[model samples]
Target: MSYTIKPWQDLTIQDDYMFKLVMRRKPICKRMLEKILHVPIRDIRYSDDEKTMKFQYEGKGIRLDVYVADDKGTVYDIEMQVRKPSDDGLYLRTRYYQSMIDMGLLEEGADYDELNPSYIIFICPFEPFDKGRHIYTFRNVCLEDTSLELRDGATKIFLSSVGTADDVTPDVKRFLEYVNGILSNDAFVQEIDQEIKRVKKLEEERVRYMTYAMKMQEERKEGIKEGREAMQHEMQHDLALKMLKDHKPIHEIVRYTELTENQIRKIAAENSNVSFGEESGRNV
Candidate 1:
């Protein structure tokens, strides 16, 4: 027996679709973020550029998909990824984004006197770290002595997908399960079904536009081909007439002629300046 292996395509998450679902569940995520970071979220602003919000963790460059700021000048770099990442991979990405955010604190001529707190949140569909069932939070600490603590800088929060739903809040669990695309039970499924419907509608609209664009591209290619064929035919016809005027032999003309026999005969009659039987039929 043979099994077919399918190629994996990157999951395409449209900005509008993501925003709609995320905005709907913003309160839940915000609450969770505040709880995990122990920071008060003065305000949450959704980015206007959808492309920026859709950046993947595996991609190059440092970009914070969702950025949050509090009244205390703390910045939160919030990201949503659909796949599980390794420890090295996780820390590398987190540190990259954190460093970029930290660099923004000191301007060209400004002083590094005041630095705000920055938090990086990785909300994944699968668990990336070992933190048991509930949400896991991490912060900088004294690794050598284990007594000293660096509490002013960056932090990381991982939203795990494993374990029973009873471990987390009802709203948070519902939101997580929805993000994971796992509607195991009826009640949870029903709650997420409405949001799923909205996403589907947006997907359908995107498909329609893609279909129209493809059709237009194909039509344009066909038109160009037709025009080229027509020009080629006219050029061949002119070449054949010139050859006939040179009094080329019939056998040689047949070998090299771009014209049909009837076309050659018409040229021959016109060059001879004689009225054939069908002369009055149509002007040659």
Candidate 2:
């Protein structure tokens, strides 16, 4: 026997849902960073507010989807992109964010004696660079000699072509797959069935309100159109009377109003007694 699927059985992009799927995976991210960077993480703090975060580039402001920092003063900016960005675009964002994090450490006139390392981890569904299969880690290097590497400031990690069920050692990979799977699978419908029901009810209510708003807008348009037509008719009538008083030929008034001579003459006759009073005040 086939079972009927309920319409109100889908996960919504609510804050709680996002927190559970993404932010809750902070431990995994911290573990992955520690493994890759070989640094010990004392603790991880996730920022929910966008104001606390800093950005580098212009145009559109970077509202960090998820921002976390390790206890050792190493900040990790992990962003999720549904679509892939170009290599240059990705690097630009990563470098800009990394620079912002570094700049935040020092105050004006203070000696740049000590600064903590920072890492920006970008997780994209689509692969941006053709580096290799699994993961790519990048850092600044001396162009003159391939041997020299800059280890002073920041590092970047890019995870590409990652899916729900892929063999990976890093804890970050597991968390990424889990979240992606939950979003793209029917299991979430089964797991969070009650939340799905609530989301569906809210969606239906929104649709109903939108429908009512549309109807009200249509009615307002119709009223405005009728009012405009009435004003046009009144203006045409006044024009007809003025032309008649000025001894303008009926053809002229008809041409102005796009009305036949009989119509213009009738309007003129109806307002024949009506006189346009002289200007009460003269221009100095």
Candidate 3:
């Protein structure tokens, strides 16, 4: 196993776990919503903070940064999204988050109208849309009639760290700059920095951070191991398919391709007749 040392002193606002911890504080979180949202937000309360949400056991889950609500019953899922231009799944991800949030809002038999007004705000450290606009807000709208509105009571906002436009308020821009790792003199940003420093000074938080880093490393290694195993499985299946097409015996296919006899038979059964001038065996 290889090791890489992380710089402790330079840990910035973009660090996912650290940012999550900082946002769990009510004052900091309330100020953040007020600044970026440009609204007089009432008292903020977190029912659950950074809760790992999943559809099923053993399924991939997302660790939400700040899951809180205002006094008026408006649910907010503030996410500090780690930027990745390579993954094109974020748009659907927001949709999924919105659905999950709504599902958890009310009792099982409650009417749909009982759902709270929800916001899934994603703070992306990288410019997502490649536009210069700092903030992008979306809601359901009618495409047939320009004047018609869906008014679904759900809002999805995306905040980009690298945006240069004046679409957002100056305070919002300052917060974005702080999230982008630029040193800031803004009062709210300074408060965030101070809280981060205090959190770092805590013996408990420090120990947790160390353990979190070790867990992250292990997860990374496990992910690499899973990827390699998947690749090898795919290769073996591909070879089994070719051998099946050539009418190779199952025992020989199993010996040479590392596939079980049942698997090889199943693959052959799926694609035994090559009528359309195609390979007779399925790759999977």
TM-score winner: 3
| Candidate 3 Cα lDDT to native | 0.79
Which runs of model 3 end up more than 4 angstroms from their true locations?
1-5, 103-113, 272-284
User: Model 3: per-residue lDDT, tens digit, 197-248?
Assistant: 9888887877787788889889889988998998999999888888766666
Could you tell me which residue pairs clash in candidate 3? none
Q: Would you give me the overall lDDT of model 1?
A: 0.57
Best-to-worst ranking by lDDT: 3, 2, 1
Assess candidate 2 and give its lDDT.
0.57
Query: What TM-score number comes out for model 3?
Result: 0.86
lDDT of each: 0.57, 0.57, 0.79
| Runs off by more than 4 Å, candidate 2 | 1-21, 24-29, 35-40, 51-60, 107-113, 163-176, 179-284
| Per-residue lDDT of candidate 1, residues 83-168 (tens digit) | 55655787677777765666655532425556677777777666575545646667778889767878666677777656453566
Q: Looking at model 2, report the run of 10 residues with the lowest lDDT sum.
A: 275-284
TM-score of each: 0.51, 0.49, 0.86
Ranking by TM-score: 3, 1, 2
Best by lDDT: 3
